[model samples]
Target: MRAKKIYWWLVFSLSALPSLYFGLIYFLNPRQLGIDPVEVLLAESGQWAFRFLLITLLCSPLRRLKLRFLSRYRRMLGLFSFYYASLHAVIYVVAWIELDWPIFIQDLVSRPFIYVGMFAWLVLLVLAATSPKAVVRALKKRWVILHRLIYVAALAVMVHLWMQTRGAIGEVLLYGCVLFLLLAERLYRAVPLLNHQSVGKSANN
Candidate 1:
């Protein structure tokens, strides 16, 4: 039990390394991030958000592949995903936009990608808000239905990423492929059960 606790702490610390690394760079040697540190921060945070989200999505498939212990850390991974997403949003608003209401309004009107990214972040916000054990217990079966919105969030994020650039299709495609495989696994598992349910219903009829 003590060993398990230590392992959990280790996993938690490792999971936080990305943010810590960025934080230290920003504080210690902001020049390393280039001249536009805010833009660098925004880009890195957004990328890590998707990376962590993809990793969180992988937990279920990994468990199915016999690495069941990963299931225990799924919630932690998901929260980390939300953490990076929130960080991205905060940096964009606080530093990038500098709370410039007029500019923000102009961007909202002009940039469709911003709309998509905001929607994804809002979904993440909902998921994070409902992530607590007490809330999960209170929500009961509804929790599963609500959490499925993570897929929508992931899809929106992909759209947001794709919209951001027309030049580099490679990075966008990589993230898209990872999300596709993760989603495909869920659909693969669900189809058989859905077919079985249909057969059972027909037999009962």
Candidate 2:
């Protein structure tokens, strides 16, 4: 099982290598893309971040189905989500705004979408920082409470993506639909009937 988990991470990391390679190409040769290079970077980073957010959300649903032991990789997926979000923010600041203080402040205050994205990233930061087993042990009950921030973070991420997309929101709507279904699944399975069945199985074991 441990070997299989390591292999999965390797696969994801290898697949992500292309993104890094493209980023470098954009850095060394901005004219490669017809659009602004910074815009390209931002779009890519944001896309991957959302993809990872969805991946993290899938862990629980997959677990319920008794699919492979995905819970072990939840922290990895979560940290990757945070990593891409940070990259997105950095590109926005360094490439887009050139780290302009006044403009940064203005956007943060005036742009509701930016605010939501920023809040989501902040929550991811806290979660990623405290994901260590030692911290989880020390925090005990509080760990569970803090982890609830994932729900809020997911909402913020979806809203951010929805706001960023221009006309014909088909892609955004599709992602929204999937996540909505995921949440519904979680709720339906939370019923006492399902809980009783689960408890019964545990007792039998």
Q: Estimate each model's TM-score.
A: 0.92, 0.86
Q: Which stretches of candidate 2 lie over 4 Å from their true place?
A: 1-12, 15-18, 193-205
Measured by C-alpha RMSD in angstroms, how accurate is candidate 2?
Answer: 3.7
Mark the 10 consecutive residues where model 1 has the least summed lDDT.
Answer: 196-205
Per-residue C-alpha lDDT of model 1 across residues 56-150, encoded as one tens digit per residue: 88887887788877678888989999999999999998999899989888887888899899999999999999999999899977787789899
Q: What are the per-residue Cα lDDT tens digits for candidate 2 across 56-123?
A: 88877787678756565788888888888999988888988899989999999999888899999999
In terms of lDDT, model 2 sits at 0.81
Best TM-score among the predictions, by candidate number: 1
Flag regions of model 1 displaced more than 4 Å. 197-205
lDDT values for all models: 0.88, 0.81
